[model samples]
Target: MGRSFFRRDPATVARELLGCAMLHCCDGEWLGGWIVETEAYLAEGDPACHAARGRGRSNASMFEPAGTLYVYPIHAKHCVNLVTENAGVGSAVLIRAIEPVWGIDAMMQNRNVSDLRRVTSGPGMICSAMGIDRASDAMDVTRADDWLLTGGHQVADRVTQTPRIGVSRAADLRLRFFVDGNRFVSGLAREHTRPRRDVLGPDKDPSR
Candidate 1:
């Protein structure tokens, strides 16, 4: 069985998540991407976090037990975010970017873009390719029905951490991480502030 996404700490889970597979069933077809990057948003008095104000209808999942999928719309586009940590802790890991692996043809059809690099690197693009929408906000990540986080071969050798993007309050947070040198990773030229780590740890094989 695949490692349960709910059984890990939010910080550890965020770092270990790179290269995992995000699968979604759309129109009787399976579409997914390799998780090349992510961002950690802890509830720790973060003004930019929705949970900063405490739980509500839209952000209830953030307060629920870990492993919930918290999808929401940003700038009129849907983005997929995962809830982490224990209930009422209000921590989450935003799936910032992905590298299209399976169903590239289907993703192209959905995005209508010939440039493969632009199809799934950003939050909005990933959602567009995976068919995520506002209706998918409360999805359960551990389920195989509509969405699931599956284990996969970890191909990312170097993971770089940097500040999150487009956030007014948490602009200085060194929480965003990406697979170094991957074409699908965003902001390749930007200087990172945090230390890079081997994505899968020492015990894991480099080639899975």
Candidate 2:
């Protein structure tokens, strides 16, 4: 991932991150998967954004430089966010789901599951499997060689967009983007969006 890529608008970065692989080095091993799903939280009038009110302790990292990690907890489950836009501007892209493309056995052990889908298909689940937590907050993802997005992924598949899930406010902004038809791309089971539409077409051979 380049600096310019993450420095763009939150919605653009969220959609463009559909196929990039999130690489994380753990215990001397590189573990991660394709970022199949994402959601954008803006700093302006977006009610779902943490900075909608203004910068504070809980959302200070959202105002950090682009590519900073903003990990937070909700209902005992943690979710990771990539800080986007400029410093103090307050915006980030949520890494909603990842298809576990590496370290299957380790992920299974971490998540204590046998099924692939159960291992790392959701935001919190992926955080658990990848050893991501509040400790990762404020870390610069762009500078971390071990925890950065890698290129060369060819996702020749439909990219779908819909309103964000879980937030009661501004839940119909169509800010969530995901790889259409990917089984491991999480959240579809709990949250359903009507009249979903495709935003991007396949560029090359998709992950499938």
Residues 26-133 of candidate 1 have per-residue lDDT tens digits of: 887767777888888877857777788888888887776677778877788887788887767888888877877667789989999999788888989999988888
Q: Which TM-score value belongs to model 2?
A: 0.88
lDDT, model 2, position 14: 92
The candidate that achieves the highest TM-score relative to the unseen native structure: 2
TM-score of each: 0.85, 0.88
Each prediction's RMSD over C-alphas, in Å, is 4.9, 4.6
Which lDDT values do the candidates have, in the order given?
0.73, 0.79
lDDT of 2 by residue, 137-194 (tens): 8988778766868664555446778888788999889999888767777665434233
Candidate 2, residue 52: lDDT: 86
Clashes of 1: 0
